[model samples]
Target: MTDRIATFPDWQTKPTVSPVQGDLVYPGWLAGSWSMSSTLVEMVAPLAPEVTTPGFEGNRQFLNQPVVCQVRFLPANVVERNKAILPLLSLPTQSLVNAQIVSDRAFNGLNLAKAYLGDRVFRVWIDPRDSNRLITKFRDNRKLFSTATGRTVEQPDVDHFITTELFQQFFQSPEKPYKNQVETTTAYTHQPDNTVTADQFTAVYLQPPHPKAFLAGDRPVALYHYQLKFVQQGVR
Candidate 1:
């Protein structure tokens, strides 16, 4: 994981992985509500004119653009659950100390999707019992189902963390179901000033349903790198 961060966008292959079964734990420092911003710093089309993935061209407009949202990391003991699936779980300040931290995926996912996709996103729900599966509903009658198939995590020190997750996206619509693979690797650091920053790299791959899947093999057709900043906002 350390080597992957040092290499950055030159990543030649996918990161190592293991089956994703439960919630991904984080370092103690990350347990709090945060106001975050993600800016696209760079992008690359590895396969280029030969094999371009969907959205590769459309994403160019996002270069240097930042998406702002509210996100949180919480301890397992305080996360809220209900039949409503609202995901607006409350975070008690007193309970966040020295606890096992985990990402609030459903809440974070919905905020993130809307930040980028705008008002087109209707809602996002993650299976309450399983963090790996999530369904997204869009206002245009489009739906997206995603499953985290594999992941890898490393904490080399008390303040730094590195992780990679591999997932498959199944887009459902009247025309057909579009399938693809996505890999995201991120390195996060807790700064002395009580803020957090991360370097994130994302790659999009073509699946068998796509005509160039065989030719591309494991190479990513589209690659994107982002810079993220998080400041504690004391619960949204």
Candidate 2:
């Protein structure tokens, strides 16, 4: 049996170009402080043997419970210069850059018990190799280790933009209870109310033989669908 880890799309070898010099533009719309409400709408365990099995029933607890969070996007300089290593290597230091900071009373809704999950900071940059793609690196935090790659679909004529991000998350310590990968797709539409409504869907995957797996082999463990709405409050 092969013991190799799963391979994801490579971001390191992707060409890097100065943001302004390429079609790959930083997502300017994401800049600003906003209040976000995220609701888990659906959950499914694809590989489970019985559709109505008790193992999957626990997912219902998250349905329709909206968790609120404070999300802020700041200029890259807001982050310490020492933390800017990844983005600085490919993009011009003087160019416009963005970093996202997220905090939630419900631990960003990941914890239903409303535990305190420390603030998460993320740096965003255009993929030098693909203009249609963007890469984000989550800074070191006490909670988790994650990296995400996203692809954008823009319809400038209709003012609609959608970005789908694939995220890989690993427990900081091997003893941590669970570890999984998630994909979230968010759609943005400009509303007449001067607010952008975002709808998101997230799917969770776990390798078989994983500590938290319901089945005994490698495959998807669960899928979670979420709806999120963002209302801009002010500039960060």
Candidate 3:
């Protein structure tokens, strides 16, 4: 997993990750609310001429702009104790006993999607029994169903956590249903100043139903990188 983040935009094939089962655990430090700013710094189309991605050119408008949103990770009693990690002691007001730190996916995902997709986003929900499945619904009656097929996690230190999840996505569209693979890798650092910073990389791969799927194969056709800064609420 370290090798994947070290390589950056040199990505070609998908990272080899284990099958996703339970919610991804976050470090104890990340167990709180945060105001996040995500800025798109770079984007690339590896096979532009032959297989340009759908949103390659349209995304250029957001190149240097930061999308601000609210997100939170919390401690929850995950279903499987085998996947549990020792979370820090809970706050006086918050009881996190026998809980594993996990992202509030529905709350965080909804707010984040609205930050980019605006009010057009109707809802974002995850399967109650399955942490790997997610759905984002739009007001236009379109929905994006995503399932985390594989993932990998690493923690070099208590202050640093890295995770990469590979998702199989199906989009309900007016013309046709679109299927693709999306990979997101984020390296988060907890700073001494009580803030958090991260480097996030995303890749989009064409899948079977796509006409040029054969040409793209397992390689990603579109790549994007974002710089993320998070500040806890009420903190300077």
Runs off by more than 4 Å, candidate 1: 80-94
User: What TM-score would candidate 3 get against the native?
Assistant: 0.89
Model 3: weakest 10-residue lDDT segment is 79-88
| Model 2, C-alpha of 79: deviation from truth (Å) | 4.8
> Which candidate achieves the best TM-score against the true structure?
1
| TM-score per candidate | 0.91, 0.54, 0.89
lDDT at position 29, candidate 1:
85
lDDT of 1 at 179: 90
Candidate 3 C-alpha lDDT tens digits along 35-67: 999999999998888897787899999899999
Report the lDDT of model 3 for residue 80: 31
lDDT of each: 0.83, 0.45, 0.82
- Candidate 1's residue-wise lDDT over 46-80, tens digit each? 77898897778888898999889988887765554
- Number of backbone collisions per candidate: 0, 5, 0
Could you give candidate 2's per-residue lDDT for residues 27-80 as a string of tens digits? 555445567777877676665653222335765766898777655444444432
RMSD to the hidden true structure, all candidates: 2.4, 11.2, 4.5
- Error at 222, model 2, angstroms: 1.7
Give the top-scoring candidate (lDDT). 1
Clashing pairs in 3: none
